[model samples]
Target: MDHEKVNILLVDDQPAKLLAYEVILKDLGENLVIASSGREALEVLLKTEIAVILVDVCMPELDGFELAAMIREHPRFQKTAMIFISAIQVSDIDRLRGYEMGAVDYVPVPVVPEVLRAKIKVFSELYRKTRELERLNQELEDRVRARTAELENSTAKLRESEQRRSMAIAAGKMGSWDWDWITGDWMWDEGQYRIFGVSPESFEVNPANVQALLHPDDVDQLRKAIAEFNSGTRAYETEFRIVRPDGEVRWCVGTAAATIDANGRVVRVSGVTVDITERKRAEERQNLLAREVDHRAKNALALAQSIVRLTRADEVKAYVNAVEGRINALARVHTILSLSSWQGAELSKLIDEELAPYSLGGQIRLAGPEVQLLPATAQTLALALHELFTNSAKYGALSTRSGRLMIAWQAENDRLTLTWEESGGPLVRTPKSRGFGTRSLLASVESQLGGQAQFDWRAEGLLCRLEVPLTRKTAASPAPGKFDAAAAAELQRASG
Candidate 1:
């Protein structure tokens, strides 16, 4: 739940006062953001969420009261708490102005530290709870991307004989059967005898014998189909298995209908059966492929979940933006794998797609041998590249007109090493703290793919190198540019 911590903004012109406020609130363990002036405070508010604002009443450029007014005008901050800290004496009108501008409380300077801390705690708790509730509601209403359905329309064949039964006949000579209730007799066509592996001369045709030949588990299915046909349905089609005299189990699709007299009494029944063993086998194969696809899709979603949980941002809007961008990068990789039928993807293709958003402008270069990556390798590598490209655009080579970037890679033995070099950008300085971007980059290259990530912060620019292990030599995930056997089995194992 600490992930739900809120930010507290302290605005003041004097550095000493800001330090004092920080000392008082540091014990609260919430994020403390300080701005030296009202304009700077407003900038912080624009990019970061502030559960409670501690503002100095008197400041250069923009005062606390004016800043509160501007903040309240925006719907997003209409209810955010503002506590004005004033050193001088306060009058009734001054208090009213602060209250009207969304001030929740006021602090007198040479302030009582305890009172300020207590006020901030209450608003921060309220803000965190509100955001949590909204998150839960959004999750409950979450809609899945898309779902595909395989539909097989069933139609009844028209009855052509005098008994007036109906069926949608198949192309081949289908085994036919008929029974008369009044005469208590049964008849079968030559095709029916051939299907049952029997001859009329050797075996007698009767309802009892026919029922005995049905697979034990499918007896109910046949009974149910006939029951439905007798219950005023014109025709019914059902698939079931049967045991022949030779003891062979064969799947059969039987279409049947009942003949009804004028008084609506069922008198005769007739139907046709077709050998559908091959079709049933085909259906089983299709089902296995569907499960493989399901497993692969879940793996991609799991990576997206990691990005959401691990990403860090100053504000809700920024957090959401970061997550969306990372997911889009993951989605593009999936799209590429899908186009290659999930066997594998070209390494150059993945790089090209990641670079498509940024124009070369004679500032970027790429050098790499043609390489192919297994499905899993391509996904993780795509995310790492996206992070690098996004960071460069924000603060490195791509951010400046005079800057330049070059990416090169080579495959040697069982490892692939890729280097990214930037020049002509702002002078490089190592950050004192590691942010989510840096951590995620390392995680993708090192933890995910069993690779090494080396970063060098030179005075002139930044450099990054990644050494990733190639896919193992396994039939499921073959060497680069190779796919054998059914990819479904390989993909399913990879997903696991």
Candidate 2:
């Protein structure tokens, strides 16, 4: 018999991409449908059956994630495979969200022909298998109904119907069981044997055999549920863990109903058992993510509070500007962190952003290896850089057209040393007294970051050197946020 082709849907605002996808998948011998927008995609999906969907992540009106979520809500499309393609970097959180929204896979913008074709082929085959299984189940139900109505069927026909029923049930991870309490008799189907990791030819239908495969910790819960059912509970549902013969533990849930005799005594019980190991694992991961979000929120609030509390200004305008600048710096760093799923950010990118206004022309020079700063370290550095940038614009190298600033850094032996050298500006001189700016700068480096900062006053300009302790692993763990007044005062006094 000639096989019917499964339809593959391609969605993107760009026609070029849709055309490319069509060419790549045309050889698979599947029917391809192209849609330029999400609304159009939905219309096509409603009209025709789709085995797989390839959608662009960044689109007008509806993005790939929103499209996937909507499609998943439709019962007919819940099992359809969806692949998300994006040009932007996918963070850990974004990848997790994609999976949660029913995305089967993710592909980068520059599509690999071989990889894309292989993934689509696999899902398409799976779709065909699922359709076949559904057809088999429908046939089995039909045969059973026919046998029930016409009880005069031949023995061979009856045997074929029984085989169909068993095959249909064996294809799924669920099974039915029956227990006769009155006669100490039990019965299980082929599906039940597969669920318990055993074969019908080697398995026995008895309480001892069933209990032996149950996890030790969950045995009591199961027995308690049985006791409750015995004590007049008509129906009850409970969960337990099954320890398979291969030493793998899997979670299972069952709903059973008691069959009462004429005198109100239990005679038999029947129910369906389902494997739910993946669901349990998803729940655990969600709990962990919740805790991590809470931790990050607290860290951000602490950093913001410190910035607002320690900032000082002589006038209302100055105070507002100072507070705003510091918070804006924090916000910039937060954006970079979000792109990396709150991981560390590169040192060069952070400096370029903080000094964007003064970065016009060749005034700002930077020399450093690619260094990823811990998220906390980046926050601390952002606020401190804001102070330095502000000072430079008002009184340092950036204030003059002919002036220049050179920023350099070196990382060696698990430490990062940086310098800010300003030249060709007004002559520099040592101040007679320590001001709020000096104290604030010292505290940012010495207290929150646990780093060292040294100032040099020259006739031409000023140069500052910083030594920070950093490593890759330190990104997740942060230093204390509280500012130390005594330490800041001592550093300021010594510097003066």
Best lDDT among the predictions, by candidate number = 2
TM-score of 2: 0.55
lDDT tens per residue, model 1, 197-235: 789898888868888889999899867876776677878
Q: Measured by C-alpha RMSD in angstroms, how accurate is candidate 1?
A: 40.9
Candidate 1's TM-score reads: 0.42
Give the candidate number with the greatest TM-score. 2
Residue pairs with clashing backbones, model 2: none
TM-score against truth, every candidate: 0.42, 0.55
Candidate 2 residue lDDT tens string, 45-156: 9999999999999999999999999999999999899999988999989999999999989999789999999999999889998899999999999998898667656666
Against the reference, the lDDT scores of all candidates come to: 0.80, 0.83
The per-prediction CA RMSD against the true structure, in angstroms, equals 40.9, 35.4
Off by over 4 Å in 1: 1-281, 473-496
Global lDDT of model 1? 0.80
Model 2 Cα shift for residue 420 (angstroms): 2.3
Candidate 1 least-lDDT 10 residues: 145-154
